[model samples]
Target chain A: MKQLRHFFDLVARTLFVLSSTPFRMKEFSRQLYFVANGSLPIVLFCVGFAAIVTILEASFHMKLVIQNDSMVPGFAALLILRELGPVVTALLLTSRVGAGFTAEVGLMKTTEQIDALRMLGIDPVQYLVVPRLIATIVGTFLLALLASMTCLLGAMFVTDIHLGYSPAMFLSSMRVFVDFQDLLLAGLKGAVFGAVIPLVSCHFGFLCEEGAEGVGKATTQSVVVSSVSIIVLDFILSYVFSYV
Target chain B: MIEYRGLVKRFGAKTILNGLNLRIEEGEIVFVLGTSGTGKSVLLKNTVGLFRPDAGEIWIQGREVSKLSEHDYLEVRKVCGMVFQHPALFDSMTVYENVAFGLRRFEELSESEIADRVKESLARVHLKGIEDKKPPQISYGMQKRVSLARTVALNPRILLFDEPTTGLDPVTTRAVNHLIFELSRKMKTTSIVVSHDMECALEIADRIVLLDKGSIVTQGTPSEIKKSEIPLVRGFLEEVLA
Candidate 1:
């Protein structure tokens, strides 16, 4: 309980420090660009290709085994919207933005900058971690939305060409099964994933020791921990959402 | 004023400060001189409640400080500003922000008031300009002065310096010594400086305390300490002043 109280104090201090400083829009925008904008191409590519592959396999299996193609569009959309979209986006971000945060903070720790903040009466968590957390949630929210839309469109294209289904028919079928709740679930999951990655990455950074070797160890630990945690969280959240 | 009575600090089996007793008056610039690993830094940290003694009492300005809660410790810390061995400036912040960090946090000053205090503190350390520069962009001596500026910005009643001139060249060391003397007098702040350099200690101390093996071997005016006949004191004086 004493440890929990200290953690709460640290979180409160972080919030206060961020509020005291004027928001640096330029810096935040640059980070947002890296976290959201720069990852767009990779997110689109992975999500789009997943759609194509899922449609092809589902159509083939249904025709051969069950003699039905009625649920192909709904199945693909549900899988993409609820599972693949959120998980893939989070995995890419965990590797890219999460690793960068850990490295930057780890270097600062090695240089005694965090100690400097403490001596100067500034809580390091407040000055460094809180702003990054806010930016992470915001960036991840937008990226998940974009990835979901692009995946659905790509699946529609695949159905039109391969299945001889008209674009109008594919669109109408998607509209029938896709609800706003699935999109909300994916965005919420992305935001949660974004929040967790940095928290774990920074925990590693804060525990960093001295010298270059320590930084290498910390960076490696951050990547492994963040990636595994994301996968596990996605599974749990997906299970809960499916049951509900 | 500060007093430590029968202070005992031990790290497992290692004794750092053993049965130490000392007192400081207001506006006195006392130099604590000792060899390396003699617990000078630990002693200084104990004054601000950073390190609690194993069995002792620390009284600062008529208040028992070692047992204060965190909130009260914050208040006690505000009454003292510390200049670490190295200038511990915030790397991401400019010089002005570094100096203004404490003032903004501990006081309810407006932006302009905080700005004025920063300028005044910088001027006190002869760092009038260069507020826009980062700490690393400055010379080692200037970095020390910026640390002083940051320390003095709070206008604390006590200023604790932990090995203020350990790694500087002779010229920079001399400059820092002069600043220490001048600022303590001008601000009338009780300054507790820890150093292994006997020359620096002799140059600025109103009273000199020598510690050996976690206890005060002897203490006197600089002249008195210099003339002491105790073998340990004489040996240390010989080696450090050599």
Candidate 2:
């Protein structure tokens, strides 16, 4: 519970600093490059495979239960747009970007660079946490949109080649079960999960102790907490969006 | 001017700084000498609000600073500069950016003026032409010099150096010691150097405070410290003598 409060405290401080300070375009671009560009290929690779597996498994289950896999494309499209794309991309980012933030900031704390920054009269929150939080939020949202498109294309290709359904047939089925709101909410989930990650990671980073072991522990904790947060938030957003 | 009265710092169950009290006057060169884990670095950190004291008052220039907000601490931070134990240069920035970083924030110098000061500050540390290089490309000693250059560029009234000469060679160590003395005397800079360099402490420090178990073991002028029979002082002096 105390740890949860600390996480909110970090978010509050970073938000306060962000409002007061001028936007750091250079630092934001740098962090965006690290969070978005650096992790893009890996996230795309994993989510494409995940989407394919979803289609195959859904088809198999439909055939087993009711002896008709004709609705596989619609069901797969619904699942991918609603859950697989945003949640998988966010979890991947939690591991890639969130873990990196924890270790990097934890190292800065241990090496006294954070203190050096404070001594220079630069708020570490403004300089370190703000840029990262904004960047991850922006990057994750964009990545979610792109990952959803890629997943749909991959699903279409697999349905055509493996399941003997044409791309046109797949799209017709997909449009029936999924709409633009699902994609928008997926992007919204991406943005919200994005906000949680750097705040949680940097909170652990600031609490890091003195040694490689401390940094290692902080990294593990950040990744676990971020991944878990993404899952819990996925459920919450799903419930909230159900009403939407 | 900095004063720590009844300062205490703890980490979990263990106390690092135990009811420590000390005062540093303006333009004085105070060397805090201590064995490892004696809270030397913690003292330096507390002075700058990096680590707030668990208990007691830290008055800097007659203002109680231990309880200041981080935003409030900025006003005090502007007057002080600290060189950390590590080079502590930002990994992503070049040496020039690192040096000019504080100046751009603290002062409104023009770009050319910042460039000139960055060159001059780096040159003072006998570091030339490495301005464009990142810290990782340079040797550790050179990075330390760059770190010092970054601190001194702002012309801070109080300079807190944590192990300022730890990794430098003999020549650079002497040069740093000379620079400390020169800055204190010429600029009227108040300096608190936390170090294990007894020889340099004896040579250049106006006063030396030996700390043990998070408390002051002894403190005096170098000559007075030289004459003291405290085992810790004698032990430190014996190393220099040998």
Interface RMSD (C-alpha) of each candidate?
2.7, 1.0
Per-residue lDDT of model 1, residues B110-191, tens digit only? 9999999999999998887799999888887888889889889988899999888877988888888999999999999999
- lDDT of candidate 2 over A1-244, digit per residue (tens): 8788888888888888889889999989999999899989998999999989988898888889999888999988888888988899999998889989999999999988998888877788898899999999999999988898899999999999889999999999988999988988889998998998899899999989889999999999999989988899999999998975
Could you tell me which 10 consecutive residues in candidate 2 chain B have the lowest summed lDDT? B179-188
Q: Which regions of candidate 1 are displaced past 4 Å?
A: A1-76, A100-125, A151-179, A214-216, B6-20, B33-38, B50-55, B107-113, B210-220, B224-239
> Ten-residue segment with the worst summed lDDT in candidate 2 chain A?
A2-11
- Estimated TM-score per prediction? 0.78, 0.95
Q: Give stretches of model 2 more than 4 Å off.
A: B169-171
lDDT of each: 0.83, 0.91
Model 1 C-alpha lDDT per residue in residues A1-244, reported as the tens digit of each score: 6534654565566567677867757666766787888888988898899889989999999999999886788778887888778888888888888888888788777655665565556556766777677778788878887888788888889888888777788777777888888888989988988787777677777767777889888888888988898888888887887786
Docking level for model 1: acceptable
CAPRI-style grade of the A/B interface in model 2: high
What's the count of clashing pairs in each model shown? Answer: 1, 0
Give per-residue lDDT, candidate 1, residue B147: 87
